[model samples]
Target: MIKVGDKMPAGTFTQITKDGPQKISAEDFFKGRKVVLFSVPGAFTPTCDAKHLPGFVEKAGDIKAKGVDVIACIAVNDAFVMKAWGKAQNTDGKVEMLADGNADYTKALGLDMDATGFGMGVRGQRFSLVVDNGVVKQVNVEQKGEFKVSSADHVLTQL
Candidate 1:
């Protein structure tokens, strides 16, 4: 998996905007900025909905106060699903909902988890990374079925 000191890979994540779907490149989003990039296996899943995403949304202001330029949530779902989940979570402009629809970014990061047993196919492992100017500064990847790390609070502490 990609670790601290590694540069973020080149990839595109879709974002559903008012004008429709938009493509955002990793370079454009993370280059020259401090970013907190967190990934969930799927959007609107139990743990993700109840804890992961909400934690980031709630702590976004404090995180940004630490000099973070962007707080983003990525999932292996489509832009439409990401948009809907963002709306449901009331994330709106607080967190950028990035859709890694085909698991491109997740695979590129080497964080892809085989969730076939759960009938979810390929998904991203629960993880969070602090990236400064596209280079990873810190990373917290959770063990399977665990949520001990890769949390907003933990990431905040790291920051």
Candidate 2:
């Protein structure tokens, strides 16, 4: 898994909107900004849908109040699924949902977890990272199936 203070890996992912495709680069997302980035195993899954993501959405206002420029969520699902799931979660355009469809970004960051035993395939571990101007400042990765850390409130405390 990625650790705090490591230079964030370079990667690009697709974000689909009703209009068309939006290509997002990791550097561009974090450059000259204070970004809170969270990752889930997949979209619409139990823990992620119930706790992980909802916490971010609920505390987004507070997070932004602390000078955060962007709050982003990433998963191994494709852009289409990510977009639909974001809408279902009632994301108020406050959080950007990024699709790491082929595990490219996940693997590049060294946070990919294998769950093929349960048929989850290659997926990102549940984690949150704080990036300042494209540099990693903090990282919180939860134990498998556990949601103790890596929540918005937890990261907010760090900020």
Best model number under TM-score? 1
Clashing residue pairs in all predictions, respectively, total: 0, 0
Model 2 has a clash total of 0
Pairs that collide, model 1? none
RMSD of 1: 0.7
The regions of model 2 sitting more than 4 angstroms off are none
Q: Which 10 consecutive positions of candidate 2 have the poorest summed lDDT?
A: 1-10
Scored by lDDT, model 1 comes in at 0.94
Task: List, residue by residue over 34-104, the lDDT tens digit for candidate 2.
Answer: 99999999899998999888999999999999989889999999999999999999885678899999999
